[model samples]
Target: MTTLQWTPRTDAPRALVVRDGHARLGPAQATEMFLPFLEQAGFEVQVAESSEIYADRAVMERTDLIVQCVATSAISDAALRGLLDAVEHGTGLAGWHRGIADAYRNSSDYLQLIGGQFVSRPAAPDEERGTDESDRSRCYTVDLTDEGRTHEIMAGLEDFTLRTEPYWVLTDDLNDVLATTTYAARPDDPWHRPITSPAVWTRRWGDGRVFVATPGHSLVVLRDAHVRAIIQRGMLWASRPAAAA
Candidate 1:
């Protein structure tokens, strides 16, 4: 039998921001955009140097939410276990783009926790290339599902278009998909049919919640009002709720 120790919840929730990973938007930019918003939302925000802090049980115990922007990085077994344990105990986890979807490539545990993995973002065939490579950054719409329109994080939001890297992710049915984007097959592409991927989703992990929005490739994308609102709200939605007084 395993014994669960009690940890007190604070009035102002704590948010741990992990920005360690290779990305076009460095840690500074990502932190700059997110830190202030978190503070304004009444969170005691801390930007972690690396994923190592995930193993800090003392810190994890008080943590109400984790906003991770790590991409293509490695997480130690201890750290991964700590993170999973924290969430399993009620701490929230949320991220956008490669932050959550493209991270911890080697950890099946992390993948299972998040419920999705980045496969590839198929680009237009070489023959379709333009001098400016407009085909590469094609515009596409993120269509909202019925649930999305009513979901707390995306309530009253309408379908929106963005011209950025359209992600093609491999996701599980466990996710409550809120929005999606479809990739059209080009003549030069091998696939004969369209490929649709989840643009935004949420998952229930034990007592915690996980939120992912696969659109923030650049600060420009993150600046989109819809994207910004979703990410901000998602962080809050995923956080551990305060205990009754």
Candidate 2:
């Protein structure tokens, strides 16, 4: 597989705004990794530290792409409105794991825009103490579908393995499934029998595009060769198209 070479758009540099709304996972680390990645990929990235993204009017209007690292929570009314309006008019939004899925847990409008949520992880028993430093992390293999192999976002990538939390999401509105992981229930398990969980998918919400991957729980997972490629492509694909909506 040839390494992708990005060609810059001359009309105006593609602008990407990243919001670290949840503050669960360290916000500093999220910005450090993603900002450089977007810059190298030919985008002008602006990092926002506020929980309320819509509060910044200038950033909201100029943003061509929004990468939200926020978990489920109450966002300001203006923030929600700005984000929804931006996407409706054509601004791409993308994120991996709980950042997008767990965001705005109580808002139906937010869910409608992103297309899904983190319902439950049936395979793993609910940890009473919640995810912490000592939670057992394991290695898992990801299988890319034929469609994944053909899509630009996943093109040239081979099946790869990574060590992280294998999130089992429940969603029915996904449009294009690029990759999935196989999960087998333990003999003592009481929830699900066995299931294949989607690790990556693309969905359309209004005029904007939503790309999500359930694999980016740790920095190690994001830095993996195949994982990095998938994310890089997904970010580019999720950005609002360079045409009038």
Candidate 3:
């Protein structure tokens, strides 16, 4: 992948948004939805087609925030190192759904940076073989954790229901879990009990911050007021402080 070129700026904080679409969602839709918001927040936003832009060490060093939406893509070693180094040096990283959780399957460092991995979305027991994959989403509730009630990003948000993919993620204690969703095991499920996974989380990686949310599977889900607020706030909360930037 070729590195994207851009002139570095000092007037305002910079945000690097990497967008790549797969299946139902398109980069255009995601960009259209988030670009204006970033700009309005006084950020100098640079849109990239791939994570390869991470290879530009000069730009990455000045970037205050990165909002990536690419899924299931492999990032080159130099690019991956550049990204991790940028974040470790105080750049903020934020993403939603597969964009963060399911991305970079080959890179353990990337996984450690984000602090979560997409595992599986077990189908409902009533779901039949050969069922239309698009309509398989079921309604589930996202309940805030105790810390989430006071956390700046999740404060005052009530438990909300979303009819979308219920992600079962693999995460460690390093994450500061803000919200969660429970998967009730039906009789047919291999696991005999309920399982809960982090629906939203934040982590401190060196001098930087990382934010992840698991509910954004489509444009509709992303448009939900609660979901949108969480993501937007998460981005801001993860961004390098204006003074620091």
Model 3 earns a TM-score of 0.92
How should the candidates be ordered by lDDT, best one leading? 3, 1, 2
User: Stretches of candidate 3 above 4 Å error?
Assistant: 1-10, 21-23, 125-134
* Model 2 poorest 10 in a row by lDDT: 1-10
* Shift in Å, residue 118, candidate 1: 0.9
How far is 192's C-alpha from truth in model 3 (Å)? Answer: 1.2
lDDT for each residue of candidate 1 in 68-98, tens digit (9 for 90 to 100): 9899899998889889888888889999999
Q: TM-scores of all models?
A: 0.93, 0.83, 0.92
Q: Report the lDDT of model 1 for residue 59.
A: 80
- Give the range of the ten consecutive residues with the poorest summed lDDT in model 3: 1-10
In model 1, the worst 10-residue window by lDDT is: 1-10
Q: Sort all candidates by TM-score, best to worst.
A: 1, 3, 2
Tens digits of per-residue lDDT, candidate 2, 115-168, equal 666765543434422466466455567999888889888887888887677777
Off by over 4 Å in 2: 1-11, 21-24, 55-57, 122-133
Pull out the clashing pairs in model 2.
Answer: 72-102
In candidate 3, what are the lDDT values of residues 1-245, reduced to their tens digit? 44433343457999999887465556558656988899999999998887889888777977999998988889999989889888887889999999889999999999999999989896754753346765658878899999999999997789999988788999999999999999889887888899999999999998899999998888999999999999999999999988777
CA-lDDT, candidates in order: 0.87, 0.71, 0.87
